[model samples]
Target: MAQMTGKQYKESLKKVKPVIYYMGEKVDDITKHPAFIPHINAAALTYDMALAPEFEELCSAKSHLTGERINRFTHIHQNHDDLIKKVKMLRAIGQQTGSCFQRCVGFDGMNATYSVSYDIDKKFGTGYHERFKNFVKMIQTKDLMPSGAMTDPKGDRSLSPSQQKDPDMYVHVIEKRKDGIVVSGAKAHITGAVNSHGHLVMPTTAMREGDKDYAVCFYVPIDAPGVMHIFGRQSNDTRKCDCSMDQGNCEYGCVGGEALIVFDKVFVPNEYVFMCGEWEYAGELVERFATFHRQNYGGCKGGLADVLVGAVYSLALAQGTAKASHVREKLAEMIHLAETIYCCSIACSCQGFAQPAGSFQADPLMANVTKLNVTRNVYEIARLAHDITGGLLATMPSEFDLHDPTVGKWVDKYMKGSSSVPAETRMRLIRLIDAMTCGTALAESMHGAGSPQAQMIMIERRGSLERKKKLAEKLAKIGDQPVLIC
Candidate 1:
């Protein structure tokens, strides 16, 4: 097998039988469902773009394991350049889709597991590294999209997994069999879960010896018996199925189509299990995954911000306000914020270093900073966009009203911003702004990869404050005997 084309990718889903439910109805074919199609379209581009000559350099990579050409999404970061290209690739796709393509999660998961498995093997003489490499090869060869399942539905935030009132609140290995193990629980807000080929399940947080059962990582086909996905609702998701103009970015939808994936004692074969009871190493895997994942916010969100900035500018033009001093100033601010995000991603990538397993990772401190900035900067960019676009962005007439014979003329007349620009054109741009700057899109920016607090935690641990203090003391000559200051 080789990298699949977009058409081939869509056709591949027919063979996948993940149990999916949306709006109280069983979804038989996610590729065909209107609600899921936009997201599927967004993901399929990851395949199509890799083959395009214009994007091949960024979207495709030579597999380190097999020396075969593979989608970069499936390739392990073999060097610092590979890490940098990952950010470029994400931005390229984000620019095109103007929404979440939903593949980076698994890409980060593979890289995190690759290095961690090797360390685990070195420490415990386990074969996890080899198993993980084989799994990576399969994904690369077949061009599969696997959701990285990490966040568990913790019933009580204060309690550790082992102390939870319900053991299944966190995904755990309930029974270890000779062949493999049975995992039971749910992964919430799992991006692309309903549309992916399978899931790379990992522990959500660090674990102690008592939490051994919860320190599990493995792969399971989405359609495995006892597995089911409940598709999540977005702010204006219904528009995806009902209206065109109302569904801003109708071709790609807004945000990754997320879902809640449940494992009811799903059985996994030994060949697919990457980690079993390695509780001590769970934190390493989590941090590695978080770093790699956080490193993406600037690339993806920056690209999306590019589109939002364009939308606001277009709206301003349609309203004949493009030359307004305030609008121009706001546009400039949005551009600065978007590029600042891109700079952070690039900086982290440039600072990437090799791991013990011969794989590369982004600079942890900078990567966390990059994501934290995204949590705030993306919102600020959206706020500026709204300031320039006006309240019509939120109060625009529905596409239905524009099409109605009775009210159509009235909407066309009253909605006209500039007589030179079609009311339809203005409406489209406003909708795009509305879709990209509002509810679901903004929330994903704030919390995706990890929340702002999660990034702060990493930043605090990796910030090297003590080292900075030492440097400051040496510079000031105040370490052992303080020097008199002028």
Candidate 2:
């Protein structure tokens, strides 16, 4: 049980051969597919770092379960330190990739499942806790990249899973057999499905008595019999196929490689199923999973902000505006916003306490607040980056023009920002900025773990307004008496 190197990880994907479709055609080889290569490269960097001696401590951790040096992505958080390290690891990866490396969902999912399963066993006297430990042990031992398939395709926004006109709108158990249960329906916006070795499936929302069949949690291999993965497209994603210069962060592309994972009567054996029909705990499971996932935005996006801030500075220098007081001010603002997020993430992790399970959990209030800020701050960071970079971001000459035989010289001659720097350098940084801010990165920021409204709801629930009101009363000298108006 050793960690896979980047090359080993890439080779491993070649063997998966999940049934994936992109652009109306079956993706035969994702490793070489232009649409998927950037994503693969981005995820591989996670493995690449684990193998680097300099990054080994940050990227690799000794597994509490096996005592082997496992990629931090697979190791469960054991203490407050583990949680802090998780955020730092995410930021580090974000710094390198500048896009979604698409591994955190499973990491969060594993911890959530670990804690919730123990709670389930405590109440129902079930063996799901043991089952989950065995399940995750396999994941860590193999160092697998697993997607947490949580969001379901609710046919109507207003309808719940069981209330939908289409019963298959949300993934649910369709039948029960002696050997296993069969599930159907789909999970949407699944990050890295095509590249993942497996998926950790969980209920999308809280469930009631009527939604028993929908209240299920399990893990399934990506290539399972009836699973079909339809790859998603990003804004200007096609640019990767045609031009490298225009595809800013050309090596990593933009955002998570999301997909619609349709599970049509996929079978899950008893050993693989963690929760079958315990409807009451569905909400608890969802909350646990989301809290950890939300806590993650600070780290990943903060790292990405690092890259964006650097891009802004580089472009300003190339444009001879590096010393402009306003430009420097805006650059500092971007860093401030990004680091503020990191601070919240670290705070939540430091405040984390051990769950009933051995693993620790992030503070939900701070985690939600962190995500809430991320929804706004990412947009603001992008806005400041856009303002400083100028309109050339929107109207840059194509890489083709720069490489053309006749117009190449003319394009270079005119596109040059500062004589001290090359036109190509300016164009490259701007494209990177455009790719990150204008495309999937910002949208993912808004909606990755949950939408802005989702965080607001959690914040309102956890804000403890009553305590604030009591403090306000004490400040107003009301004491224990009720104040009345005439």
TM-score of each: 0.98, 0.97
Q: Write the per-residue lDDT of candidate 1 for residues 1-486, one digit (tens) a residue.
A: 769998898998999788999999998988878899999999999999999999999999999899999999999998999999999999999999999999999999999999999999999999999999999999999999999999999889999999999998999999999999999999999998888899999999999999999999999998999999999999988898894889989999988999999999899999999899999999999999999999999999988988888888888999999998988998999999999999999999999999999999999999999999999999999899888888998898998999999999999999999999999999899899888988999999888988899999989898888777766886877757334322
TM-score of 1: 0.98
Q: In candidate 2, what are the lDDT values of residues 168-261, reduced to their tens digit?
A: 9888999999978999999999998888998999998999999999999999998889999999999998898884779987799888899999
Off by over 4 Å in 2: 479-486
Between which residue pairs do clashes occur in model 1? Answer: none
Give the worst 10-residue stretch by lDDT in candidate 2. 477-486
lDDT of model 2 at position 466: 83
Clash-forming residue pairs, model 2: none
| lDDT of model 2, residue 431 | 93
Error of 1 at 61 (Å): 0.2
Assess candidate 1 and give its lDDT: 0.93
